[model samples]
Target: MPAARESLLDAAYAALMRRPWSAVRMVDVAVSAGVSRQTLYNEFGSKDGLARALVRREADGYLAGVERALGSAAGPRDRLTATAEWTAGAARENVLVRAMLTGCWTERLPAPPLAPVPSCTAVPAQRRADGPLPTPRDFVRMVRDRAVTVLAGPGASPADTAELLRTCELVVRLALSCVAAPPGEGGMAELVRAVLPRHLV
Candidate 1:
């Protein structure tokens, strides 16, 4: 992208973090970015469109982190442990993520006359001008696939490895939903202990 476009995105992101999305006006983003409203519209279409772009940017950041976590030389268990720690840590520290948890800007977006509960799950990767929690399936898939590749190492059959990965996905999803505590050293170890035994056999 052009330098101006990049500046606009950065400014928009900064604005979104400081206040609720409803409070963000396109003009404000333009002013902060040192661009005109017309330029903002040309690049981002509309506020809703800008929201989607923001979501995509954040998602890219997250996927990159996942890849980095998996790329380390650690064993499958350690890799997975580190991935979980980073994920939860990111979620906790991310301003946008905190907005979702605190319900800070729930009504900023246009809603349908009759709509489902405003769970973060409904936000499309491209449609989300706002960042929400990672989907359970997505979170599970990343963890499971990386675990399979690293843990299986050499000589493991692909079929068995796939089975292990799928099993791990299910276990991880349940742990994410049901486990009360945040994932940490002990929590991550417990999650691995629960899934590893079943998949190892």
Candidate 2:
């Protein structure tokens, strides 16, 4: 089901690049994916549904990159630094990621098809209970939560968890700031280092 949904999303994304989101028809997406229109509708429910899924998938990819950065580094500080660098670099290169980080959509790229609504109001009860769907803001929070856990390590006390949460929140905000307006050269890493305690490093 995921693969099929991805195929549909890839088709929609391709269509979006060629023209405006308003112009990209569901029929065109279905044809591009070699699936029926009903199948597309069944998978996503509507154009808005498809758009949300696409954004979620993109967020998932970005988070996966962060996870990889975390694994590659030697320690907590190094991991946070590497992830920040990676986030800034990736956001610079990818328009979708840039939009997610900065909430600024490009003229060429499709804006999220859904209307603005509070997260709690927009998401269904079942989905909210199961896990909140990955909106861009939710993605940031998700990464922060994961980072807190990683920084805390195993058998963490409440104090350690609280401290790690604060550290991760700071790191994520700094990383996002870099994404919004890049600090050239080694500036991002330096900023991250400045904020972190020596003991954490």
Candidate 3:
């Protein structure tokens, strides 16, 4: 069900875009995914399971984008700028992403249980999803740590690395603000650059 699992997730997302999560039918999702309703159940035990898996994937996707931003060829400051910009952009475009970053789940979305549920499913992916989803604080730490790891590099003293961590946290926290009120024109890059230490390389 590897391929089918992905297809189901894709269909679930597409269905979500068309209507609220409450209105998204499992049978419809299965039809759109080209898999049987039973297959959808096998992949995700229930709609709540599907929501958890979807939220988990969205969180992973957000972090994946953060990695891409950090991996850019630009210098340290510019790279941080890119990370901030991506954070803001992702939240703006994806309601699920916005909910993940802000912890503001509206009635239209599925606010799945954040804690681990008793899942009997044998699917590893679903098991992982059954576990706690990242909180907004968790997302902040994750993005900050990734930025620090990529930018700090080897040979740096522990003290400098600590300062870098603070800078990364600052950028991430500021970027999260965009979920409510986005920055103008320059997106978050300008603000990130302004806060970043001039000596960052």
Candidate 4:
């Protein structure tokens, strides 16, 4: 079922890339995945449900990239730079990610509710998908909190926690700004490094 679920999502994404979301048929997605329409419905419940799951998957992937960037072996500032780079890169590469970060859902994309939708499904993945989706502000806060957690690791002084959080927010917001209006030749990494202080927690 997990494999089928992924295959369906892949097909749905491919279809979405080719046409507007409103025109993307559930049957087409199921056929592209080589699965029955009933299987698709059983898995996602409805087209809107599928949209939520796909959007949720994109958000998860972007956050996973953020974690990887944050966990890099580089210095604290470098790691923050990496995280910022990841944020900008993810937004640029994936329209769904860009929409999630910028809160700009074009007519071609599905705009699922940021608030949680009621869930009656027994499927674990769909249930989680039906949970509250992160808004753009939530993404900023999420990235900031993750950066603070990674940098101020394990019994670090509480005194600098406030400063650290502020710095993290700056880094996250700067990255988002770059997504909207890309920086000049300096690129995201240099811009991130320049903006982040020499002392990163």
Candidate 5:
């Protein structure tokens, strides 16, 4: 996370937008980043590692936006609406997001839906070899936590958790589809806005 290393990752992500990950050779990224090939290797280890990092970075940014939008809201309904709008806008605006959607680096396997917690359990301290920590299931857990936060109002109960889960699943799915499909076709924000309030209120 040094400034220089972050600059390199930014360059790599920018390059990936113009070309598929397979075509984004290390030499090209190194040159674009104004860093040496050895440096790239030392930083990310491999192309797959770099690509995964890029994906994780994007995920982190989007989730942060959702958290911010929710925080600014005065109520559950507004928070849900803000979250939907924030997600749609982020999907439409992110070039790296679009590239990851269209590229083959992770094609065979669809990106897992966003979650509130890390996808994987943390490796025990004894299992570490002094590298970056693995991405956790926190993303999914994030989605869950936001829903719970919104639902934690007067008269709220555990019984409503199922509905909140359903709403989050639909919102995330719609945003994913929007990023992957033709522009404006996904209608993710509108879909969420229309569906969430009916269940919440």
Candidate 6:
């Protein structure tokens, strides 16, 4: 089932790149995935559901990259710099990333309402029901929380932890700003260096 879902999403993403999201047809996605239309509907409920899943997957991948950047760098400053660079680079290169960063999906199709999943009496539930679907703001908060965790090293003093979290928040805001409106000169790394504490740099 997971493999089938991923195949459907892969098809949808490929279709998105070629045309606006609104133009993508469920039948086409089903055919592309080599699955029946009923299977697609069973998996995602609706186009919006599919989109939410795709966006969540992309966001997870981006966060993984941020984690890698944090681990790869030697110092706090370098880690923040690497993260900023990754964010900016991803936004510039990936259309989906840009849309997620800017919250501007005007070029894509409108997200339709999600249909409810039908109850299956025979099959057991694979996963527990989540409270609610996360909004874009929620995704941003998740990213910030992860950044704070990475920035605040193990055995950090309470005072130091607070300061580091503040720095992480600032860096996240700066990265998002760069995504929304990229700087004409100096680049994202320079922008990050300017806002970061000199001692860390």
- lDDT winner among the candidates? 4
After superposition, candidate 5 runs with Cα above 4 Å error = 95-141, 153-155, 174-190, 197-201
Candidate 1 TM-score over all chains jointly: 0.68
Per-residue lDDT over 69-118 for candidate 2, one digit per residue giving the tens place of the 0 to 100 score: 88887888788988888888888877777787777877766565333423
Superposition-based RMSD of candidate 4 using all C-alpha atoms, in angstroms? 1.5
lDDT of 5 by residue, 1-201 (tens): 566567777888778667766677888888888989988777666665566566666766777887888788776667765666666577668754443333423443223232222323132211121223223334445665676666566676666776777777566555555555623544544566776747553
Better of 4 and 5 by TM-score: 4
lDDT of 4 at 76: 83
Task: Give, for candidate 4, the lowest lDDT window spanning 10 residues.
Answer: 192-201
Scored by Cα lDDT, where does model 3 land? 0.90
Write down the TM-score of every candidate. 0.68, 0.77, 0.95, 0.95, 0.66, 0.79
Instruction: Answer with 3 or 5, whichever has the higher TM-score.
Output: 3
Q: Is candidate 1 or candidate 3 better by TM-score?
A: 3
TM-score of candidate 5 on Cα atoms, chains taken together? 0.66
Question: In each prediction, how many residue pairs overlap at the backbone (N, C-alpha, C within less than 3 A)?
Answer: 3, 0, 0, 0, 19, 1
Per-residue CA lDDT of model 1 for 1-201, tens digit only, reads 567877887998888667777888899999999988988877666676676666556556766776777676455556665565555555566654333222343564322211122324332432343434344455566666766666677887878777667755654453444333575547765775566555453
All models: lDDT?
0.60, 0.75, 0.90, 0.91, 0.60, 0.70
Q: How accurate is candidate 5 locally (lDDT)?
A: 0.60
Clashes by residue pair, model 1: 51-128, 51-129, 52-129
Root-mean-square deviation (CA) per prediction: 6.6, 4.6, 1.4, 1.5, 6.4, 3.8
lDDT of 2 at 189: 72
lDDT of 5 at 151: 57
Tell me how candidate 4 scores on lDDT.
Answer: 0.91
